[model samples]
Target: MRIIIKGGIWKNTEDEILKAAVSKYGKNQWARISSLLVRKSPKQCKARWYEWLDPSIKKTEWSKEEDEKLLHLAKLMPTQWRTIAPIVGRTPSQCLERYQKLLDEAEAKEGADLDLTGPTGGDAGPSADDVRRLRPGEIDPDPETKPARPDPVDMDEDEKEMLSEARARLANTQGKKAKRKAREKQLEEARRLASLQKRRELKAAGIELKGKKKKKGMDYNADIPFEKKPALGFYDTTEEKNRQIEPGFTNVHLHKLEGKRRSEINEEKRKKKQKTDSEGGVGFVPARASQLNKLKQAEQISKRRKLLLPAPQVGENELEEIVKIGFAGENTKAVVGETDNVSSLSDYTPSSTGLPLRTPRLIGGSLQTPRTPLSVRSLRTPTTERARLNRRSQVVKRDLPRPVHVDELTIDDLTYEGSEIEKIIDLEMIKLLKHDAIVYPVHGSKLNSQNLESIESFEEFTDELMNQAREAINAEIKITANESDLPEDWPKFEDLTGIKQCQNQLEINRNLMIKDASRAAKLEKKLNITLGGYLVCYKVSRSSALVKKTLESFEEVEQAKIELDSFQSLNLSEKVAIPKRIETLQNEVDHLVRREHELQERYATLLNQKQEIQLRIEDLFAKTNGNA
Candidate 1:
């Protein structure tokens, strides 16, 4: 990547500066260096850049003398600063600081101080043991009594080569074995992953290879026929085979069929009533059976009862029956009780029995009164229903088919425009002949149409009526009010509790105004007026209460400021001074408020006393006015 610097300097040049920062400080600290370089001067930035780059400078020239001295120091003392520093031409401290570590390897090699020459010194340089002598107070070497350590066996040329070759082979074999094991494991894992991928692919394609499903329509037999065969050796009889009728023979078929059906129905009914032989059918109880047979033979009994309607009972006191026949021979008659003698005197009597039944007897039947038929019954209606029927007939004869009256023409009756209106009016008039039908009493069960229409018409015009009612109501209220005065105990507007309350409130206001001079002045100023000195002095009992208040407030504020200053002078985390002055001021304010409340209560009590005196004065005036 190219390092591009297009802006003002390294600080503004985002790309080049970042690259330099990364190269000098490694990629890890590049961000921090770039941030610092953004604000630092270019000289400071260049110095930091040079310091980071200078330590890692590589010198490619071979220092042959330095190498020879380095190897020489690797022998001799092997780890001594004094023996290694001169050979490197550096300080003893620098030798120990930088390269004394290079001399330390000689202590690990066997025969480390032995000169590599023949038994005596041949051409090898001086051994470390023969190099120097020490002065007094320096420790001398003890040689004669020292035990000689055995020399390590030296490797020949071929053996050294073999050892080198073995080490190389071992390293190569271990590396290859590790790589081979990793490759085998990777191959095994890849094969496992491939198997899983194959399973997923098959699952995605919806293939169930392990078990195949059966196709539809293959499980059952479809060719079986459904027919019933005749029983062996069975054949149709001649009646069943040849008794078939031709078509269009409905009457013949029905007549032939009904005869057999009637016999079957009678057989079914008889079977339903059958009794066992032991349980006394006709053969077991012949005597009782003959009695029943004699009754059936001597009397002709009918299963169905004849229906007879009683004559209509109309008048209770009158004896004559009003028999009115319609033009079509439809007779309407009113009869009383069970007597038919009047009908017998008429021309409608039967010749066989000389009875006057309503209809003539049948051709072969006689008009005989059967004394004992299926049952006997009495006259069933009560006296009250009979009386009500008599009254109902009177109403019907008086009101039926009547014309309407003019007073009874409702809005619904007015729907027709011309002749129908006259018809409805005539019908209404006919309906009104009975006094009970025309006028309904207020206590009656119902009102007639005239009364209902009059009521509805009165309600329809109620707006002016309501106004008149309101005027009458006001007049009555005024008269009632003028006839009586207010009770003696009732309060007047001026003497009521509201006036007393207002006086008490004004007194409280005055007391509150005087309780604290400064507060009173503030209240007065807020109310935009000045309290006279006399009132202030009379209320607070001091001419300089305002001054005192001002001084107190100033002192409080000064004390607060001083305390704040002291608190701020101390450490920020430290506590404030104890609030002794503020507590004292708060206690004083509470006491003043309590005094204000007490004064207010006293003022209210005085105001109540004044109100009582005024009430007594008003009562005396009322008594004088009444007596006069």
Candidate 2:
């Protein structure tokens, strides 16, 4: 006996079967309906229908109002997604996903504001994206909510059997009662035939027979049961006693056995309908008997599908020259290339060109970033030859933008550079380190490994050290990883795919400083290019003081500039120093100006927020008063 997991993305056959089952069993009776499908359960069927397959579900773009309403409702009801789902006109999963996406976007924007986006380029971490996007390897919990992939051309034996069984079960028109009645009628006929045969046999031997009288129930041969007596009319009493007349079988035609063929009836109806119409029933183009008839025919044609003719063996240049010579009225010779067997193609394509006709032509791009280098624990096995057989369908992805790196962010991960949180964390780590040093003095003692063998020879020292080690082991130190310099070191990972993940960190290269400097230089050049002269000016101002006072200046131009009277002889040294002093002052002025602008902006933002909060409170109070 084998146990199999039933749920995943649905295939075309399953979808079609589900639709048929739903039609027969109705929207309710899911348990009974589920019996028709081998893989899907009752709950999954119900969810698949309601979440995606149901006609009522909206799959269009969410409007501005819907987004606003969703956000407002989310704020009011927090994690009550199921309750909010109906109001939002979305499935619970959709509502929850959308809410999470919105929150991620907001957090990303906030991180950008705090100058913590990108790797070392003021980028805090990976930006927000559809984090809930399905990855390969792992099964989708709600495949019912996604579109079904088409079934392969060659289906399994089990699938065919399930399809046939479903067809037969759904096709049965008679109910339980109808079947029982038919069975009883058959039994009665059999009994009548048996009795008739027995009588014939007895009569043939010249034996007299009497029929048994019924003690209970009606005797059909004698009289009708539960008959109502008709009231006698004065003139109709003699006629009522007369024998009833039956239709003559001699006059009945073969066609009259079943009056009016269905085709004839339909023809008459169509003729009548035509007579009634001003220009017949159909439009300019003749109407199809059913909608999508052409489409159905085309689909049938596609199932057998045509293949494009393989490329002909010919010399293209020679052919062209021959055609040109023929046009020029000169005798030309044709050169045909030798042909090879095309039965086994190395690859498949519509035309026998290198690429397929259906494949999209990729326009070459102007710029591309180099792939990031990654650190691996060890080398993996190289991939083998590509598979020629059909592969599993790719998981459906959302239309949302894909982020470069998939990062697992936490509250402690992306705080402000000089924030209180950072300061507190640093302080806590230092404290933990100190405590570890004191309590676990074994670590400090191990720094002097030369004393290890000789320590036991000194019995008094050994006893003291052993006692301290025991005390350290007994010490109940309650500390978290954040509160200690020594990390748990459980190897962080980037959740890339469902099964495979990348290490969050890269391996340290030998020329680490060189690589770092190169990347920094490239990043600086890019920033300068994108941001313009303002950043360059700011950087120049900051580094100007250092530039003016280099080691060479301390060696050569210590007092030379002041000795030559470039300006007035009076206070020449002060004059030379005045420019450098002015530059330093100018740098200070720039910083002060930037700081003042920031403070003003922050102050204004606070005032606006405060005003809005006040207004909201007043509105709430007024509403409460009105309700009371």
Candidate 1: tens digits of C-alpha lDDT, residues 11-53: 2232334344545455445345544333334443443343223
TM-score of each: 0.11, 0.27
How many clashes does each candidate structure show, in the order listed? 11, 5
User: Candidate 2 clashing pairs?
Assistant: 116-123, 116-124, 117-123, 117-124, 118-123
TM-score (C-alpha, index-matched) for candidate 2? 0.27
Per-residue lDDT value at 11 in model 1 = 23
Residue 257 in model 2: lDDT: 87
lDDT of 2 by residue, 112-196 (tens): 8998665756543434453455557767777887889979868988789999999899787568987999999999999999999
